[model samples]
Target: MKHLLSTHDLDVPTVAAIMNVADHMSEINARSVPKVPALLGRTVASVFFEDSTRTRVSFETAAKRLSADTMSFSASTSSVNKGESIRDTIETLSAIGVDAFVVRHASSGVPVSVTEWTDASVVNAGDGWHQHPTQALLDAYTITRELGTGNTLAGVRVAIVGDIKHSRVARSNIDLFARLGARVTLVAPGMLLPAGLAGPGITVTDALDDVLPDVEVLYMLRVQRERMDAGLLPVGGEYSARFGLDERRARMLSGDAIVMHPGPMNRGIEMVMDPAELPGSRILAQVRNGVSVRMAVLFRLLGDGQLGA
Candidate 1:
Protein backbone atom coordinates (compact mmCIF):
# COMPACT_ATOMS: atom_id res chain seq x y z
CA MET A 1 0.00 0.00 0.00
CA LYS A 2 1.40 3.42 -0.95
CA HIS A 3 -0.47 5.32 1.73
CA LEU A 4 -2.75 4.11 4.52
CA LEU A 5 -4.91 7.22 4.63
CA SER A 6 -8.15 5.59 5.70
CA THR A 7 -10.03 2.29 5.91
CA HIS A 8 -12.82 3.50 3.64
CA ASP A 9 -11.67 1.74 0.46
CA LEU A 10 -9.27 -0.83 1.94
CA ASP A 11 -9.85 -4.25 0.37
CA VAL A 12 -10.13 -7.51 2.25
CA PRO A 13 -7.02 -9.07 0.70
CA THR A 14 -4.91 -6.10 1.73
CA VAL A 15 -6.38 -6.13 5.24
CA ALA A 16 -5.64 -9.83 5.47
CA ALA A 17 -2.07 -9.25 4.36
CA ILE A 18 -1.50 -6.61 7.04
CA MET A 19 -3.14 -8.80 9.67
CA ASN A 20 -1.12 -11.82 8.53
CA VAL A 21 2.10 -9.83 8.67
CA ALA A 22 1.16 -8.50 12.10
CA ASP A 23 1.13 -12.06 13.38
CA HIS A 24 4.80 -12.39 12.44
CA MET A 25 5.60 -9.00 13.94
CA SER A 26 3.78 -9.94 17.16
CA GLU A 27 6.04 -12.96 17.50
CA ILE A 28 9.10 -10.79 17.06
CA ASN A 29 7.87 -8.50 19.83
CA ALA A 30 7.69 -11.45 22.26
CA ARG A 31 11.32 -12.42 21.65
CA SER A 32 14.19 -11.77 24.03
CA VAL A 33 15.60 -9.22 21.60
CA PRO A 34 12.65 -7.59 19.88
CA LYS A 35 14.57 -6.10 16.99
CA VAL A 36 14.82 -6.89 13.28
CA PRO A 37 16.91 -5.77 10.30
CA ALA A 38 13.96 -5.73 7.91
CA LEU A 39 14.00 -1.96 7.46
CA LEU A 40 17.63 -1.21 8.26
CA GLY A 41 18.29 1.38 5.57
CA ARG A 42 14.89 3.12 5.62
CA THR A 43 14.21 6.31 7.56
CA VAL A 44 10.75 7.24 8.90
CA ALA A 45 9.73 10.67 10.08
CA SER A 46 6.86 11.25 12.51
CA VAL A 47 5.53 14.77 12.09
CA PHE A 48 2.78 15.69 14.54
CA PHE A 49 1.02 19.02 14.15
CA GLU A 50 -0.78 18.35 17.43
CA ASP A 51 0.05 16.97 20.88
CA SER A 52 0.30 13.22 21.51
CA THR A 53 1.80 10.58 23.75
CA ARG A 54 0.73 7.10 22.58
CA THR A 55 0.30 7.40 18.82
CA ARG A 56 3.56 9.30 18.32
CA VAL A 57 5.58 6.98 20.55
CA SER A 58 3.91 3.86 19.14
CA PHE A 59 4.91 4.67 15.53
CA GLU A 60 8.51 5.49 16.48
CA THR A 61 8.76 2.27 18.50
CA ALA A 62 7.38 0.26 15.61
CA ALA A 63 9.96 1.79 13.27
CA LYS A 64 12.74 0.99 15.75
CA ARG A 65 11.61 -2.63 16.20
CA LEU A 66 12.14 -3.14 12.49
CA SER A 67 15.50 -1.33 12.75
CA ALA A 68 14.32 1.60 10.65
CA ASP A 69 16.09 4.90 11.41
CA THR A 70 13.66 7.50 12.80
CA MET A 71 13.22 11.28 13.04
CA SER A 72 10.49 13.29 14.77
CA PHE A 73 9.18 16.81 14.26
CA SER A 74 7.14 18.54 16.93
CA ALA A 75 5.18 21.51 15.64
CA SER A 76 5.23 23.14 19.04
CA THR A 77 9.00 23.26 19.23
CA SER A 78 9.96 23.32 15.56
CA SER A 79 10.06 26.00 12.87
CA VAL A 80 6.26 26.01 12.99
CA ASN A 81 6.74 28.38 15.91
CA LYS A 82 8.17 30.78 13.33
CA GLY A 83 5.05 30.46 11.09
CA GLU A 84 6.42 27.80 8.74
CA SER A 85 3.75 26.11 6.65
CA ILE A 86 3.10 22.35 6.69
CA ARG A 87 4.10 22.08 3.06
CA ASP A 88 7.37 23.83 3.71
CA THR A 89 8.08 21.73 6.79
CA ILE A 90 7.36 18.50 4.91
CA GLU A 91 9.45 19.65 1.93
CA THR A 92 12.28 20.41 4.32
CA LEU A 93 12.02 16.96 5.88
CA SER A 94 11.86 15.35 2.44
CA ALA A 95 15.07 17.16 1.47
CA ILE A 96 16.66 15.67 4.60
CA GLY A 97 15.94 12.20 3.11
CA VAL A 98 12.90 10.61 4.66
CA ASP A 99 11.46 7.37 3.30
CA ALA A 100 8.08 7.69 5.01
CA PHE A 101 5.94 10.08 7.08
CA VAL A 102 3.60 9.13 9.93
CA VAL A 103 1.55 12.30 10.17
CA ARG A 104 -0.97 13.52 12.75
CA HIS A 105 -2.87 16.76 12.50
CA ALA A 106 -5.93 18.36 14.08
CA SER A 107 -7.63 18.95 10.75
CA SER A 108 -9.09 16.33 8.45
CA GLY A 109 -7.34 15.48 5.14
CA VAL A 110 -3.96 16.92 6.10
CA PRO A 111 -2.19 13.69 5.25
CA VAL A 112 -3.81 13.53 1.82
CA SER A 113 -2.66 17.06 1.05
CA VAL A 114 0.79 16.21 2.43
CA THR A 115 1.22 13.57 -0.28
CA GLU A 116 1.30 16.36 -2.89
CA TRP A 117 4.33 17.94 -1.23
CA THR A 118 6.66 14.94 -0.84
CA ASP A 119 7.75 11.75 -2.57
CA ALA A 120 7.97 9.78 0.68
CA SER A 121 5.20 7.36 1.64
CA VAL A 122 2.56 8.84 4.00
CA VAL A 123 0.64 7.09 6.78
CA ASN A 124 -2.05 9.07 8.49
CA ALA A 125 -1.34 8.70 12.17
CA GLY A 126 -4.55 10.67 12.68
CA ASP A 127 -6.28 13.66 11.12
CA GLY A 128 -9.02 15.50 13.00
CA TRP A 129 -12.25 13.56 13.62
CA HIS A 130 -11.76 11.74 10.35
CA GLN A 131 -9.82 8.49 10.80
CA HIS A 132 -7.11 6.71 12.77
CA PRO A 133 -6.30 3.67 10.64
CA THR A 134 -3.48 2.12 12.69
CA GLN A 135 -5.48 2.40 15.88
CA ALA A 136 -8.24 0.41 14.20
CA LEU A 137 -5.63 -2.05 12.96
CA LEU A 138 -4.23 -2.73 16.44
CA ASP A 139 -7.72 -2.92 17.93
CA ALA A 140 -8.70 -5.47 15.29
CA TYR A 141 -5.61 -7.54 16.01
CA THR A 142 -6.26 -7.37 19.72
CA ILE A 143 -9.87 -8.49 19.26
CA THR A 144 -8.82 -11.35 16.98
CA ARG A 145 -6.19 -12.52 19.44
CA GLU A 146 -8.61 -12.16 22.33
CA LEU A 147 -11.38 -14.11 20.63
CA GLY A 148 -9.25 -16.51 18.55
CA THR A 149 -11.24 -15.42 15.47
CA GLY A 150 -8.69 -15.91 12.68
CA ASN A 151 -8.45 -12.91 10.34
CA THR A 152 -12.14 -12.20 9.88
CA LEU A 153 -14.84 -11.15 12.34
CA ALA A 154 -17.77 -12.76 10.55
CA GLY A 155 -19.99 -13.50 13.54
CA VAL A 156 -18.66 -11.02 16.07
CA ARG A 157 -20.88 -8.28 17.46
CA VAL A 158 -19.22 -4.96 18.34
CA ALA A 159 -20.71 -1.89 19.99
CA ILE A 160 -18.80 1.43 19.83
CA VAL A 161 -19.96 3.76 22.60
CA GLY A 162 -19.63 7.49 23.20
CA ASP A 163 -18.63 10.72 21.39
CA ILE A 164 -18.94 9.30 17.86
CA LYS A 165 -19.37 12.80 16.45
CA HIS A 166 -15.82 13.68 17.49
CA SER A 167 -13.97 10.35 17.49
CA ARG A 168 -11.58 9.54 14.67
CA VAL A 169 -10.93 6.10 16.14
CA ALA A 170 -14.63 5.31 16.11
CA ARG A 171 -14.94 6.40 12.47
CA SER A 172 -12.09 4.12 11.38
CA ASN A 173 -13.20 1.24 13.56
CA ILE A 174 -16.78 1.41 12.28
CA ASP A 175 -15.57 1.29 8.69
CA LEU A 176 -13.10 -1.52 9.34
CA PHE A 177 -15.22 -3.81 11.51
CA ALA A 178 -18.26 -3.66 9.27
CA ARG A 179 -16.15 -4.25 6.19
CA LEU A 180 -14.59 -7.30 7.87
CA GLY A 181 -18.09 -8.78 8.35
CA ALA A 182 -18.60 -7.93 11.98
CA ARG A 183 -22.03 -6.65 13.01
CA VAL A 184 -21.49 -3.13 14.44
CA THR A 185 -23.72 -1.08 16.74
CA LEU A 186 -22.93 2.53 17.58
CA VAL A 187 -24.24 3.67 20.96
CA ALA A 188 -24.25 7.31 21.88
CA PRO A 189 -26.34 10.24 23.00
CA GLY A 190 -28.43 11.80 20.22
CA MET A 191 -26.41 14.98 19.84
CA LEU A 192 -23.11 13.11 19.93
CA LEU A 193 -23.89 11.11 16.81
CA PRO A 194 -23.26 12.46 13.35
CA ALA A 195 -25.98 12.29 10.70
CA GLY A 196 -26.38 9.26 8.38
CA LEU A 197 -24.28 7.03 10.66
CA ALA A 198 -26.46 3.91 10.36
CA GLY A 199 -26.80 1.51 7.44
CA PRO A 200 -26.40 -2.13 6.39
CA GLY A 201 -24.39 -4.21 8.86
CA ILE A 202 -24.46 -1.26 11.26
CA THR A 203 -26.93 -0.33 14.04
CA VAL A 204 -27.34 2.89 16.04
CA THR A 205 -28.84 3.53 19.48
CA ASP A 206 -29.04 5.98 22.35
CA ALA A 207 -29.82 3.28 24.86
CA LEU A 208 -26.60 1.73 26.11
CA ASP A 209 -28.17 -0.79 28.51
CA ASP A 210 -30.38 -2.27 25.80
CA VAL A 211 -27.37 -3.48 23.79
CA LEU A 212 -24.97 -4.36 26.60
CA PRO A 213 -25.98 -8.00 26.96
CA ASP A 214 -25.60 -8.89 23.30
CA VAL A 215 -22.36 -7.09 22.44
CA GLU A 216 -19.19 -9.16 22.33
CA VAL A 217 -16.88 -6.19 21.91
CA LEU A 218 -17.70 -3.09 23.95
CA TYR A 219 -15.49 -0.24 22.70
CA MET A 220 -15.71 2.93 24.79
CA LEU A 221 -14.69 6.45 23.72
CA ARG A 222 -14.07 9.56 25.76
CA VAL A 223 -16.28 12.68 25.53
CA GLN A 224 -13.49 14.70 23.82
CA ARG A 225 -14.14 17.93 25.69
CA GLU A 226 -11.06 19.37 24.01
CA ARG A 227 -12.91 19.16 20.71
CA MET A 228 -16.27 20.26 22.13
CA ASP A 229 -17.76 23.71 22.45
CA ALA A 230 -19.84 23.87 25.71
CA GLY A 231 -23.36 22.44 26.27
CA LEU A 232 -23.47 19.22 24.26
CA LEU A 233 -24.74 17.40 27.31
CA PRO A 234 -26.66 18.77 30.27
CA VAL A 235 -24.09 17.79 32.90
CA GLY A 236 -21.16 15.42 33.37
CA GLY A 237 -22.99 13.40 36.04
CA GLU A 238 -26.01 12.99 33.77
CA TYR A 239 -23.78 11.72 30.97
CA SER A 240 -22.11 9.27 33.31
CA ALA A 241 -25.47 8.12 34.53
CA ARG A 242 -26.87 7.64 31.04
CA PHE A 243 -23.87 6.15 29.19
CA GLY A 244 -20.94 5.37 31.45
CA LEU A 245 -19.68 1.79 31.69
CA ASP A 246 -19.74 1.37 35.41
CA GLU A 247 -19.64 -1.85 37.48
CA ARG A 248 -23.27 -2.64 36.74
CA ARG A 249 -22.87 -2.59 32.98
CA ALA A 250 -19.59 -4.44 33.33
CA ARG A 251 -21.47 -7.32 34.91
CA MET A 252 -23.89 -7.40 31.99
CA LEU A 253 -21.18 -8.58 29.64
CA SER A 254 -20.52 -12.27 29.10
CA GLY A 255 -17.32 -13.94 30.25
CA ASP A 256 -15.73 -13.73 26.79
CA ALA A 257 -16.74 -10.13 26.12
CA ILE A 258 -13.90 -7.61 25.89
CA VAL A 259 -14.04 -3.94 26.87
CA MET A 260 -11.80 -1.48 25.06
CA HIS A 261 -11.01 2.24 25.18
CA PRO A 262 -8.44 4.03 23.08
CA GLY A 263 -6.07 5.99 25.31
CA PRO A 264 -6.46 9.27 27.18
CA MET A 265 -9.61 8.00 28.85
CA ASN A 266 -11.75 10.37 30.89
CA ARG A 267 -11.60 8.30 34.08
CA GLY A 268 -14.82 9.25 35.88
CA ILE A 269 -16.87 10.23 32.86
CA GLU A 270 -16.86 7.60 30.11
CA MET A 271 -15.40 4.91 32.30
CA VAL A 272 -17.01 5.08 35.73
CA MET A 273 -15.01 2.16 37.10
CA ASP A 274 -11.41 1.04 36.94
CA PRO A 275 -10.73 -1.06 33.85
CA ALA A 276 -8.05 -2.98 35.73
CA GLU A 277 -10.72 -4.55 37.89
CA LEU A 278 -12.60 -5.86 34.87
CA PRO A 279 -11.62 -9.35 33.78
CA GLY A 280 -12.66 -8.74 30.19
CA SER A 281 -10.58 -5.61 29.68
CA ARG A 282 -8.21 -5.59 26.67
CA ILE A 283 -7.04 -2.02 27.13
CA LEU A 284 -3.42 -2.99 27.78
CA ALA A 285 -3.48 -5.61 25.05
CA GLN A 286 -4.48 -2.89 22.59
CA VAL A 287 -1.47 -0.82 23.62
CA ARG A 288 0.86 -3.84 23.42
CA ASN A 289 -0.41 -4.92 20.01
CA GLY A 290 -0.07 -1.39 18.58
CA VAL A 291 3.66 -1.75 17.97
CA SER A 292 3.41 -5.05 16.10
CA VAL A 293 0.46 -3.90 13.99
CA ARG A 294 2.24 -0.63 13.15
CA MET A 295 5.41 -2.57 12.32
CA ALA A 296 3.34 -4.54 9.84
CA VAL A 297 2.04 -1.28 8.33
CA LEU A 298 5.50 0.25 7.95
CA PHE A 299 6.86 -2.96 6.45
CA ARG A 300 4.00 -3.11 3.96
CA LEU A 301 4.64 0.43 2.72
CA LEU A 302 8.45 0.51 2.80
CA GLY A 303 9.73 -3.06 2.54
CA ASP A 304 10.35 -5.09 -0.59
CA GLY A 305 7.11 -6.82 -1.64
CA GLN A 306 7.80 -10.35 -0.43
CA LEU A 307 5.07 -10.51 2.22
CA GLY A 308 2.74 -13.39 1.36
CA ALA A 309 4.69 -13.87 -1.90
Candidate 2:
Protein backbone atom coordinates (compact mmCIF):
# COMPACT_ATOMS: atom_id res chain seq x y z
CA MET A 1 0.00 0.00 0.00
CA LYS A 2 3.01 2.34 -0.40
CA HIS A 3 1.52 3.76 -3.60
CA LEU A 4 -1.94 3.31 -5.08
CA LEU A 5 -1.06 2.70 -8.73
CA SER A 6 -3.90 0.27 -9.44
CA THR A 7 -6.68 -1.71 -7.76
CA HIS A 8 -4.98 -4.88 -8.96
CA ASP A 9 -2.31 -4.21 -6.35
CA LEU A 10 -4.84 -4.47 -3.52
CA ASP A 11 -6.21 -7.67 -2.00
CA VAL A 12 -9.43 -8.25 -0.05
CA PRO A 13 -8.14 -7.41 3.42
CA THR A 14 -6.44 -4.24 2.18
CA VAL A 15 -9.59 -3.09 0.40
CA ALA A 16 -11.65 -3.78 3.53
CA ALA A 17 -9.14 -1.84 5.60
CA ILE A 18 -9.42 1.19 3.34
CA MET A 19 -13.21 1.01 3.34
CA ASN A 20 -13.24 0.81 7.15
CA VAL A 21 -11.03 3.89 7.39
CA ALA A 22 -13.25 5.61 4.87
CA ASP A 23 -16.24 4.88 7.11
CA HIS A 24 -14.63 6.90 9.89
CA MET A 25 -13.61 9.58 7.40
CA SER A 26 -17.23 9.84 6.29
CA GLU A 27 -18.32 10.45 9.88
CA ILE A 28 -15.75 13.23 10.21
CA ASN A 29 -17.16 14.83 7.05
CA ALA A 30 -20.62 14.89 8.62
CA ARG A 31 -19.46 17.12 11.49
CA SER A 32 -20.12 20.83 11.48
CA VAL A 33 -16.50 21.88 10.81
CA PRO A 34 -15.75 18.78 8.70
CA LYS A 35 -12.04 19.31 9.26
CA VAL A 36 -9.51 17.20 11.13
CA PRO A 37 -5.93 17.55 12.35
CA ALA A 38 -4.96 14.07 11.16
CA LEU A 39 -2.79 15.40 8.38
CA LEU A 40 -1.88 18.78 9.81
CA GLY A 41 1.55 20.08 8.69
CA ARG A 42 1.60 17.59 5.77
CA THR A 43 1.59 18.88 2.19
CA VAL A 44 -0.06 17.32 -0.85
CA ALA A 45 0.62 18.31 -4.44
CA SER A 46 -1.91 17.79 -7.18
CA VAL A 47 -0.27 17.46 -10.58
CA PHE A 48 -2.64 16.92 -13.48
CA PHE A 49 -1.36 16.68 -17.06
CA GLU A 50 -4.84 16.05 -18.40
CA ASP A 51 -8.08 18.02 -18.07
CA SER A 52 -10.15 17.23 -14.98
CA THR A 53 -12.92 18.65 -12.85
CA ARG A 54 -14.20 16.17 -10.28
CA THR A 55 -10.98 14.30 -9.40
CA ARG A 56 -8.75 17.36 -9.07
CA VAL A 57 -11.22 19.24 -6.90
CA SER A 58 -12.05 16.11 -4.89
CA PHE A 59 -8.39 15.47 -3.98
CA GLU A 60 -7.84 19.11 -3.07
CA THR A 61 -10.97 19.04 -0.91
CA ALA A 62 -9.90 15.79 0.72
CA ALA A 63 -6.47 17.22 1.53
CA LYS A 64 -8.02 20.37 2.97
CA ARG A 65 -10.47 18.36 5.07
CA LEU A 66 -7.57 16.50 6.61
CA SER A 67 -5.81 19.87 7.23
CA ALA A 68 -3.04 19.16 4.73
CA ASP A 69 -1.45 22.10 2.89
CA THR A 70 -2.04 21.84 -0.84
CA MET A 71 -0.66 23.07 -4.19
CA SER A 72 -1.91 22.48 -7.70
CA PHE A 73 0.08 21.97 -10.90
CA SER A 74 -1.55 22.11 -14.30
CA ALA A 75 0.54 21.15 -17.31
CA SER A 76 -0.83 24.07 -19.34
CA THR A 77 0.69 26.60 -16.92
CA SER A 78 3.65 24.67 -15.56
CA SER A 79 7.20 24.16 -16.86
CA VAL A 80 5.75 21.28 -18.83
CA ASN A 81 4.59 23.85 -21.35
CA LYS A 82 8.26 24.82 -21.65
CA GLY A 83 9.09 21.17 -22.46
CA GLU A 84 10.35 20.23 -19.01
CA SER A 85 10.65 16.48 -18.64
CA ILE A 86 8.33 14.57 -16.26
CA ARG A 87 11.15 13.33 -14.06
CA ASP A 88 12.66 16.80 -13.71
CA THR A 89 9.30 18.31 -12.80
CA ILE A 90 8.69 15.67 -10.12
CA GLU A 91 12.21 16.12 -8.76
CA THR A 92 11.57 19.84 -8.45
CA LEU A 93 8.31 19.20 -6.59
CA SER A 94 10.07 16.69 -4.34
CA ALA A 95 12.60 19.41 -3.48
CA ILE A 96 9.70 21.41 -2.05
CA GLY A 97 9.08 18.73 0.65
CA VAL A 98 5.83 17.40 -0.75
CA ASP A 99 4.60 14.40 1.23
CA ALA A 100 2.39 12.97 -1.52
CA PHE A 101 1.42 13.52 -5.14
CA VAL A 102 -2.07 13.06 -6.55
CA VAL A 103 -1.17 12.82 -10.22
CA ARG A 104 -3.30 12.53 -13.34
CA HIS A 105 -1.50 12.14 -16.65
CA ALA A 106 -2.57 11.54 -20.24
CA SER A 107 0.01 8.79 -20.53
CA SER A 108 -0.39 5.45 -18.77
CA GLY A 109 2.20 4.58 -16.04
CA VAL A 110 3.20 8.21 -15.45
CA PRO A 111 2.15 8.05 -11.82
CA VAL A 112 4.12 4.83 -11.33
CA SER A 113 7.09 6.47 -13.02
CA VAL A 114 6.67 9.49 -10.72
CA THR A 115 7.12 7.22 -7.70
CA GLU A 116 10.75 6.62 -8.84
CA TRP A 117 11.48 10.34 -9.21
CA THR A 118 10.35 11.41 -5.73
CA ASP A 119 10.20 10.06 -2.19
CA ALA A 120 6.57 11.21 -2.08
CA SER A 121 3.83 8.57 -2.21
CA VAL A 122 1.84 8.66 -5.46
CA VAL A 123 -1.95 8.32 -5.77
CA ASN A 124 -3.00 7.83 -9.33
CA ALA A 125 -5.89 10.16 -10.12
CA GLY A 126 -5.99 8.69 -13.60
CA ASP A 127 -3.86 7.76 -16.60
CA GLY A 128 -4.48 6.92 -20.26
CA TRP A 129 -7.04 4.09 -20.48
CA HIS A 130 -5.46 2.69 -17.36
CA GLN A 131 -6.61 2.64 -13.74
CA HIS A 132 -8.41 5.24 -11.63
CA PRO A 133 -7.90 3.52 -8.29
CA THR A 134 -9.44 6.22 -6.12
CA GLN A 135 -12.51 6.43 -8.30
CA ALA A 136 -13.06 2.70 -7.98
CA LEU A 137 -12.50 2.93 -4.25
CA LEU A 138 -15.08 5.65 -3.86
CA ASP A 139 -17.48 3.78 -6.11
CA ALA A 140 -17.15 0.65 -4.01
CA TYR A 141 -17.60 2.69 -0.87
CA THR A 142 -20.72 4.26 -2.29
CA ILE A 143 -22.19 0.91 -3.21
CA THR A 144 -21.48 -0.59 0.19
CA ARG A 145 -23.02 2.42 1.92
CA GLU A 146 -26.15 2.51 -0.18
CA LEU A 147 -26.72 -1.22 -0.35
CA GLY A 148 -25.90 -1.81 3.34
CA THR A 149 -23.68 -4.60 2.17
CA GLY A 150 -20.89 -3.73 4.59
CA ASN A 151 -17.38 -3.84 3.06
CA THR A 152 -17.62 -7.19 1.33
CA LEU A 153 -19.22 -7.61 -2.11
CA ALA A 154 -19.65 -11.39 -2.12
CA GLY A 155 -22.43 -12.61 -4.44
CA VAL A 156 -23.19 -9.07 -5.59
CA ARG A 157 -23.64 -8.92 -9.32
CA VAL A 158 -22.41 -5.78 -11.05
CA ALA A 159 -22.81 -4.90 -14.71
CA ILE A 160 -20.56 -2.19 -16.14
CA VAL A 161 -22.14 -0.84 -19.28
CA GLY A 162 -20.76 1.07 -22.27
CA ASP A 163 -17.37 2.41 -23.51
CA ILE A 164 -15.23 -0.36 -21.96
CA LYS A 165 -12.49 0.16 -24.55
CA HIS A 166 -11.82 3.72 -23.36
CA SER A 167 -12.93 3.83 -19.72
CA ARG A 168 -10.27 3.64 -17.03
CA VAL A 169 -13.10 3.62 -14.48
CA ALA A 170 -14.49 0.42 -15.93
CA ARG A 171 -11.09 -1.27 -15.81
CA SER A 172 -10.48 -0.32 -12.19
CA ASN A 173 -14.02 -1.23 -11.14
CA ILE A 174 -13.78 -4.65 -12.71
CA ASP A 175 -10.61 -5.37 -10.80
CA LEU A 176 -11.83 -3.97 -7.48
CA PHE A 177 -15.21 -5.69 -7.64
CA ALA A 178 -13.64 -9.02 -8.51
CA ARG A 179 -11.18 -8.77 -5.65
CA LEU A 180 -14.02 -7.90 -3.27
CA GLY A 181 -15.92 -11.04 -4.30
CA ALA A 182 -18.40 -9.55 -6.76
CA ARG A 183 -19.27 -10.99 -10.15
CA VAL A 184 -18.59 -8.40 -12.88
CA THR A 185 -20.17 -8.44 -16.31
CA LEU A 186 -18.74 -6.03 -18.84
CA VAL A 187 -21.57 -5.01 -21.19
CA ALA A 188 -20.55 -3.28 -24.37
CA PRO A 189 -20.57 -3.73 -28.12
CA GLY A 190 -17.87 -6.10 -29.33
CA MET A 191 -15.82 -3.32 -30.90
CA LEU A 192 -15.93 -1.32 -27.69
CA LEU A 193 -14.69 -4.20 -25.51
CA PRO A 194 -11.04 -5.07 -25.04
CA ALA A 195 -9.67 -8.50 -25.90
CA GLY A 196 -9.31 -11.16 -23.17
CA LEU A 197 -11.40 -9.29 -20.55
CA ALA A 198 -13.66 -12.24 -19.77
CA GLY A 199 -12.49 -14.95 -17.38
CA PRO A 200 -12.96 -16.21 -13.79
CA GLY A 201 -15.13 -13.74 -11.80
CA ILE A 202 -15.78 -11.64 -14.95
CA THR A 203 -18.08 -12.03 -17.93
CA VAL A 204 -18.49 -10.11 -21.20
CA THR A 205 -21.51 -9.48 -23.36
CA ASP A 206 -23.01 -7.09 -25.87
CA ALA A 207 -26.62 -7.63 -24.92
CA LEU A 208 -27.64 -5.39 -22.05
CA ASP A 209 -31.20 -6.72 -21.79
CA ASP A 210 -30.12 -10.22 -20.95
CA VAL A 211 -27.98 -9.11 -18.00
CA LEU A 212 -30.14 -6.27 -16.61
CA PRO A 213 -32.62 -8.51 -14.79
CA ASP A 214 -30.07 -10.19 -12.54
CA VAL A 215 -27.50 -7.50 -11.78
CA GLU A 216 -27.69 -5.61 -8.50
CA VAL A 217 -25.59 -2.69 -9.71
CA LEU A 218 -25.91 -1.11 -13.14
CA TYR A 219 -22.85 1.07 -13.73
CA MET A 220 -23.08 3.14 -16.86
CA LEU A 221 -20.13 4.82 -18.52
CA ARG A 222 -20.12 7.93 -20.66
CA VAL A 223 -19.24 7.54 -24.32
CA GLN A 224 -15.68 8.81 -24.64
CA ARG A 225 -16.15 10.92 -27.72
CA GLU A 226 -12.65 12.34 -27.31
CA ARG A 227 -11.22 8.85 -27.64
CA MET A 228 -13.39 8.02 -30.62
CA ASP A 229 -11.99 9.95 -33.55
CA ALA A 230 -14.06 8.12 -36.14
CA GLY A 231 -17.64 7.07 -35.53
CA LEU A 232 -17.88 3.90 -33.51
CA LEU A 233 -21.55 3.65 -34.18
CA PRO A 234 -23.85 4.63 -37.00
CA VAL A 235 -25.52 7.34 -34.96
CA GLY A 236 -25.94 8.50 -31.34
CA GLY A 237 -29.65 7.72 -31.31
CA GLU A 238 -29.15 4.13 -32.36
CA TYR A 239 -26.60 3.62 -29.63
CA SER A 240 -28.80 5.30 -27.05
CA ALA A 241 -31.83 3.31 -28.11
CA ARG A 242 -29.95 0.07 -27.72
CA PHE A 243 -27.44 0.66 -24.91
CA GLY A 244 -28.38 3.80 -23.00
CA LEU A 245 -30.11 3.58 -19.62
CA ASP A 246 -33.29 5.39 -20.55
CA GLU A 247 -36.52 5.29 -18.55
CA ARG A 248 -37.53 2.12 -20.33
CA ARG A 249 -34.30 0.32 -19.58
CA ALA A 250 -34.41 1.60 -16.02
CA ARG A 251 -37.57 -0.41 -15.43
CA MET A 252 -35.82 -3.56 -16.51
CA LEU A 253 -33.57 -3.41 -13.46
CA SER A 254 -34.22 -5.84 -10.59
CA GLY A 255 -35.95 -4.64 -7.49
CA ASP A 256 -33.51 -2.81 -5.20
CA ALA A 257 -30.97 -2.59 -8.01
CA ILE A 258 -28.97 0.61 -8.00
CA VAL A 259 -27.88 2.80 -10.92
CA MET A 260 -24.48 4.47 -11.13
CA HIS A 261 -22.51 6.64 -13.52
CA PRO A 262 -19.08 8.24 -13.40
CA GLY A 263 -20.19 11.47 -14.83
CA PRO A 264 -20.01 14.38 -17.13
CA MET A 265 -22.92 12.34 -18.45
CA ASN A 266 -24.31 12.49 -21.94
CA ARG A 267 -27.88 13.67 -21.28
CA GLY A 268 -29.49 11.72 -24.10
CA ILE A 269 -26.77 9.36 -25.09
CA GLU A 270 -25.37 7.06 -22.42
CA MET A 271 -27.92 8.21 -19.88
CA VAL A 272 -31.38 9.37 -20.81
CA MET A 273 -32.76 8.99 -17.31
CA ASP A 274 -31.61 11.88 -15.17
CA PRO A 275 -29.18 10.43 -12.66
CA ALA A 276 -30.28 12.87 -10.00
CA GLU A 277 -33.92 11.92 -10.40
CA LEU A 278 -33.46 8.19 -10.62
CA PRO A 279 -34.82 6.46 -7.49
CA GLY A 280 -31.82 4.25 -6.91
CA SER A 281 -29.07 6.35 -8.45
CA ARG A 282 -25.81 6.42 -6.51
CA ILE A 283 -24.22 9.04 -8.75
CA LEU A 284 -24.19 11.90 -6.24
CA ALA A 285 -23.31 9.49 -3.44
CA GLN A 286 -20.14 8.58 -5.32
CA VAL A 287 -19.08 12.24 -5.42
CA ARG A 288 -19.64 12.68 -1.69
CA ASN A 289 -17.86 9.42 -0.82
CA GLY A 290 -14.88 10.40 -2.95
CA VAL A 291 -13.69 12.93 -0.38
CA SER A 292 -13.82 10.39 2.45
CA VAL A 293 -12.11 7.64 0.45
CA ARG A 294 -9.34 9.99 -0.64
CA MET A 295 -8.90 11.18 2.94
CA ALA A 296 -8.52 7.57 4.04
CA VAL A 297 -5.96 6.99 1.28
CA LEU A 298 -3.95 10.06 2.27
CA PHE A 299 -4.06 9.08 5.90
CA ARG A 300 -3.03 5.52 5.06
CA LEU A 301 -0.09 6.62 2.92
CA LEU A 302 1.03 9.75 4.80
CA GLY A 303 -0.20 9.41 8.36
CA ASP A 304 0.29 6.64 10.95
CA GLY A 305 -1.48 3.41 9.99
CA GLN A 306 -3.59 3.45 13.16
CA LEU A 307 -6.82 4.73 11.59
CA GLY A 308 -8.06 1.36 10.37
CA ALA A 309 -5.87 -0.78 12.59
True-structure RMSD, every candidate: 1.6, 1.6
| Residue 303 of model 2, lDDT score | 91
Candidate 1: tens digits of C-alpha lDDT, residues 1-309: 488889874677777888889999989999999999999989999999999979999999999999999999999989999999999999999999999999999999999999999989899999999999999889888888899998888879999998898889999998888888899999988888899777779989989999999999999987776544477754677888988999999999988899999988888888999999999999989998999899998998899533232
Computed on alpha carbons, the lDDT of every model, listed in order, comes to 0.89, 0.88
Which candidate's lDDT is highest?
Answer: 1
Clashing pairs in model 1, backbone N/Cα/C closer than 3 A? none
lDDT of 2 by residue, 148-249 (tens): 889988888999999888889998998888888889999888888988677678988889999999999999998876544477753687888778998878
Give the C-alpha miss distance for residue 179 in model 1, angstroms. Answer: 0.2
What is the C-alpha local distance difference test score of candidate 1? 0.89
Q: Candidate 1: where is the Cα deviation over 4 Å?
A: 227-229, 305-309
Total colliding residue pairs, candidate 1: 0
Candidate 2 structure, TM-score to reference: 0.96
